[model samples]
Target chain A: MAFEVKDVLIVLPAFNEQASIVHTLNDIDKNVPGANKLVVDDGSTDKTADYARQAGAQVAQLPFNIGVGGAMRFGFRHASRNGYKVVIQLDADGQHDPAYIPELLRNLDQSDLVIGARFAGEGDYEVHGPRKWAMGLLSTVISRSANSKLTDTTSGFRASGPRAIELFAKDYPAEYLGDTVESLVIALKSGLTVSQVPVAMRKRIGGQPSQNAWQSAVFLFRAATALIIAYMRPTDPANEPHGEKS
Target chain B: MTYFIGPILSIALIAIIVTQLMRKRLRERHALWWAIGAITTLFLSIFPGILLNLSSWLGFVAPLNLVLILGLALMLLVNLQHSAELTDLENKVRTLAEEIAELKLEDSIGKVNVSDFPESN
Candidate 1:
């Protein structure tokens, strides 16, 4: 499967990342030039949209701060409408290397969605405390659901082929932890295949990690709720009327 | 005092619901639930013996306990309904926002194309 850059859209769901939005765009241009790029501004109060537009990528400014899940859903809808066959979701903070984009896209030949797994023996990215435990628990459960061993289920760096793209364009969850953990469960339940490739995590160019020690302590409860709800949700997303007008 | 407070509370609830309906602040669909609840409360307050007999028949030791549990159950149902409605509204809003952004991008791209091609009128 020869995947062309022209058939892919790099979706950067950014929220107030004015400092590094330009650098992220430049990195994509340098690494994957001619690939379609979209920056969902995610209701940034900063100049993230302006920077992205100036960097020559298409910009979609959401009317409110709808979080990463909502922003990525917007990207999927745009891709679905615009005839893009693949979408690569990269972090706006530059922690995800654009260089691994090809490797992710290549794995899409075998699976509907390919996750850029950090802990899959590729990156030195380390997490401790309750956060690591939560990630391990989530990955163990979700891996079982997917019927495949998955090391890092919470990594935002991922690529979606056409099947996953179409499903996500309509049924992507926009809740807390929905974008990563819940999303994989939905994909697996929807009969879409998921695979992962090892990628080294880079230091974020700017902004702060949203998680703190207090939040990590609360992560276990939230992760469990999200996973349970994801599994309990109707497998046929169309039944829920996610795309129903009015 | 208990009878007086019951009637007063039910009346206040009904009054607020009515006011909201009149002001167009609450939809008829939503007000319907509260109206039924307030009317039931009013009826029970006026005829306290009915509740006393019903509670005993329903295997409750005290009428007040029955009232408290019923109220709590009603509140939980209402809260659950509100959450369902809210999730629906959020989904709708997200779809609309995405649509608007996509349209704007298309419009801008169209404008850029027209300018780039000077010969195209």
Candidate 2:
């Protein structure tokens, strides 16, 4: 698929990333050039929305923090409405290196969804403590479910094709599990082909991750349970009120 | 005694819920469910034998245990219902926020193309 600025929309769901959003937006403009850019400022109390607006990306200012899933949903909706064929999800924190965006989009030729998996080939990302263990457990569960080799179940850097975009725009997990693990599960179950590309992520350029070590531990447990429940839920077209739009 | 304590507590609970419902502080749908709960507790408290008999049929040996377990189960269901309602409200708030943001952008950019959307609060 040829990457066109008008045809591709890179959605960065940001929360309190005022310091990093401008840099992230700049990277997209510099790296991808023609891809339309959008920032879903997930109800940041900080000036994240303002900074993104100033940076010239179309901004969707969420009144409050609605988590990544809700923000991604809005992103896909904007893509479908504005006639973009490819939508890429990036992090506002600048961890997701925009340098690999071309490779991710290229892989979209073989897959409906392309995720920038952190540990796929291992460049330099390190994980230890309870966090490492949680990722390992999640990787195992998600890989087993998706029936594909996936190294990073939590990587937010991803690309979506038209089919994946419209499905998510109607309904995506709006909370903790929706952003990562369950999203892939829902996509795979809904008949969208998913693949992962090896990408080395950079460290955060601004604000801390949404959760600390302790909160992540709690989140890990909750995410595991939600993933189990989500598996039982088959993505039925009848379940959604909206129908048939790409 | 069960007479003075249980009935009075149930009546008091029902009265509070009823007043809230009448004042429109609580939704009628939710209040109706709570009213059923208050009335069930009142009935079970009045005729403890009904619970004891039902518990025995369900293979429970202790009536108090049955009462407490049932009460806990009902409370859990109510909590689950609240969670569902909360999730719905969260989605609504998000949609409203995004819609307003889009409108603000259109207004500032002088596009004025969003007249189709109903004005949202």
RMSD of each: 4.8, 3.8
Candidate 1, residues B8-90: lDDT per residue as tens digits?
99999999999999999999989887898899999999999999999999999888999999889889888999999999998
> Lowest summed lDDT over 10 consecutive residues: which window, candidate 1 chain A?
A237-246
Best by lDDT: 1
Name the 10 consecutive residues with the lowest summed lDDT in model 1 chain B.
B111-120
- Cα lDDT over the full model 1: 0.88
- Candidate 1 scores a chain A TM-score of 0.94
lDDT tens per residue, model 1, A43-120: 999899998999998998888888899899989988898889999999999899999998898899999999999998
lDDT of 2 at A127: 69
Worst 10 residues of 2 chain B by lDDT: B112-121
Give all candidates' CA lDDT scores. 0.88, 0.82
lDDT of 2 by residue, B13-92 (tens): 99999889889999987876788889999998888889878999999888788878877888888889999999889778
Label model 2 with its docking quality class. medium
TM-score of each candidate's B chain against the true B chain: 0.86, 0.85
Sliding window of 10 residues with minimal summed lDDT for model 2 chain A? A237-246
